[model samples]
Target: MKLSPTFLSRIPALFLSCCLLLAFGCSDSQDAVEPTLDMDSKANNKSANMMKEYWVEINPLNHSGVTGQAKLVVEGNVLTVEVWAEGLEAGMPHPQHIHGFVENKGNATCPPPSADVNGDGLIDLGEGVPFYGPVLVSLTPFPTAEDGTIHYKQTFMLGMGDMIAYQALKPLQNRVIVLHGMTVEGTYWPTLPIACGQIMPGNSMGMGNR
Candidate 1:
């Protein structure tokens, strides 16, 4: 059947209405999807600015009741260290270092007491140096407002040795930490390890800003 002229003239308005409805629906769908995309972008940006935290819980190795936390935050090439301890002798500068070995071959393993092949009744730092790399950070406890207490927090740029350790993708690789007591006259250093902790690794670092 042939449409009347009036009906044909009103067809344009109906077609316009349908077009408007389709456009609105498409716009609503896009609006819904954009938030998830935006959220993902924000998360990416946050990760870009900050790396995953590497944390270590220190426990008494020789000194009883000694407990603390060691935190490392690596942003870019710089590593920030935050270490605090309790049950320590006040006003003492307890030397702490990373004594984990990272190598592809011999002398690359950080051994336990069983490693003392000679059974000389001592585990020398020099002997472990070959196995567990050098002391990456030697911490000095700063005197707190309270008498004889210490709080150690410092930032260090990644050096050649540390950069090598950080590159190791293994969890807790090359992060055996030792907190030593002050040297005493006629006392062998092996007994000085007051507290010990192994720094467990975390997720991979993020790249720069998006």
Candidate 2:
């Protein structure tokens, strides 16, 4: 009718062990709930859908020196502008970019890099509006040599939507497309828009219009 000393001693150790196990068990359970990327499953399901597709038809206005078509694709914030020229030679940088609220081709110069029209210091929504001008995202200058056929592509993420969306919307409201010109000491211009087009929106791809 008496508990053994060994048994009594073992009860406390057993209870302590159980408590430790429960604590660790709950901690492990919580850790498992943390988010984790199912990369394998995603990789299996991933297809062309991840790739963005867009088509922009650019034409020159009030100028005969430059003309052509440009295609673009937006994956997230990065924009890839591809130029397909008819009579353009090879080796030109093209000096191209997106201007916010641009009125005319010869009205202003390409927005200088790190330019903040709103003086907000941060290139966020509404910063590139007041200037309301074109920005040189990327360019393919006049062919350095003679290729006879101009075809160049460039990628850029100028933080436009994140900074100049409001200003960009105005120009975009009227089928604005990509514009190309020249660059001189980060301040070239008359950006004689050589190639131009209207950005058309489709089901899978198109301009955000803002």
Candidate 3:
């Protein structure tokens, strides 16, 4: 059946109405999807930045026989840890392993002492050790500063060192930083930590913003 002119005109209105409805639906769907997508993108970007702008700094409090500070900086899987000792006379390479969590700053209790690489609680040392290989940012050993201060810096690119434990640690939490009585070779230190500090904010202080 042939349609009249009036019916044909109505057809245009119906077509337009359908088109408008479809357009509105498409726009609503896009709006919904964009927020989730944007949220995911922001999360990923924040995680990337968290990895990039992480750092830790230690300041020693004494000089007689023990006292020093260590600073750690992590960026995009690369980690740089530096130690400054006031009266570091020097000795054999000491044993250095990421100690477990310490309940108190004055006590000697360490969390189940596993080999933590990232300072994280994970059992794998590969995720935490920055100097293992691709995770190293820089490693520098220097003489005592002009004022009788001992300084050592180590850098490693991402994926280089055994950082298993480091990666297991909770982000932006507190971890222990221990300085052996001697150099970090393979042997354990004396009864307690010669020097120690807490890993705060996962090197976030070094970052310019948040």
Candidate 4:
């Protein structure tokens, strides 16, 4: 084939233009992919910041026959708590609380009958403290049992102290819910631990009574 000098001399420029077009096409494709990756990262961060929920299955302690369930939800700096129980002393105020150890010092749990160190045959508040830790959040304006049942719900804004305690309560499996007050006629009856439940993750469905 015979070609003119002018046409042959322009071949390098034509090749250069094709290379530039390919480079630009590849750059534009990469640029398009980056935004999708960025959007995925943002979506994951939003999910990580969403709300979490926990549940507890309250069981009778000290033979008081009190049983209950509790739900706790955490969203940002807000916490919502709900507790439902029966077999409480009718017409008597029962103080309930979320209990956990500070700084992971000990494992939180529901005290067994063997926790009654004084041979009193009843696990009182002091006896249960070692297993359940100190009261972290007092669920108050303490609910009074109406017709031998208690239904309680409250929401709280995490204050400095509460936030600190909540940080300790992270992985809430080691925390507990304790209901105080019993029908026994005694000086320590009001502070007796009638029901106790360990906090577990997730909703209450299929959770066996403990």
lDDT of 1 by residue, 5-51 (tens): 55336444532332343244233323323222132577646644767
TM-score of candidate 4 relative to the true fold:
0.71
| Candidate 3: tens digits of C-alpha lDDT, residues 1-210 | 122355336345433432343244233323322212132576645644654333434332111155554556665445666665555435323223223321121222222324344554332222222211111111222232345455666765433332322233223234445443332234322212344444555444443222
* Sliding window of 10 residues with minimal summed lDDT for model 2: 162-171
Global lDDT of each candidate: 0.47, 0.39, 0.36, 0.67
Ranking by TM-score: 4, 1, 3, 2
104: Cα error in model 2, Å = 17
Candidate 3's C-alpha runs over 4 A off are 1-46, 51-64, 101-149, 157-161, 182-192, 202-210
The all-Cα superposition gives candidate 1 an RMSD in Å to the true structure of 29.1
Candidate 4 global CA lDDT score = 0.67
Look at candidate 4 and give me any clashing residue pairs.
Answer: none
Top TM-score: which candidate number? Answer: 4
lDDT by residue (91-200, candidate 2, tens digit) is 33333444433334223222232544455432321232233233423243323224534566776542332222212222232334444333323532323344455544
On lDDT, the candidate that comes out on top is 4
Clashing pairs in 1: 90-148, 91-148, 101-132
How far residue 87's Cα lies from its native spot in candidate 3, in Å, is: 1.9
Report the poorest 10 consecutive residues by lDDT, candidate 4: 30-39
Q: How close is candidate 3 to the true structure, as a TM-score?
A: 0.41
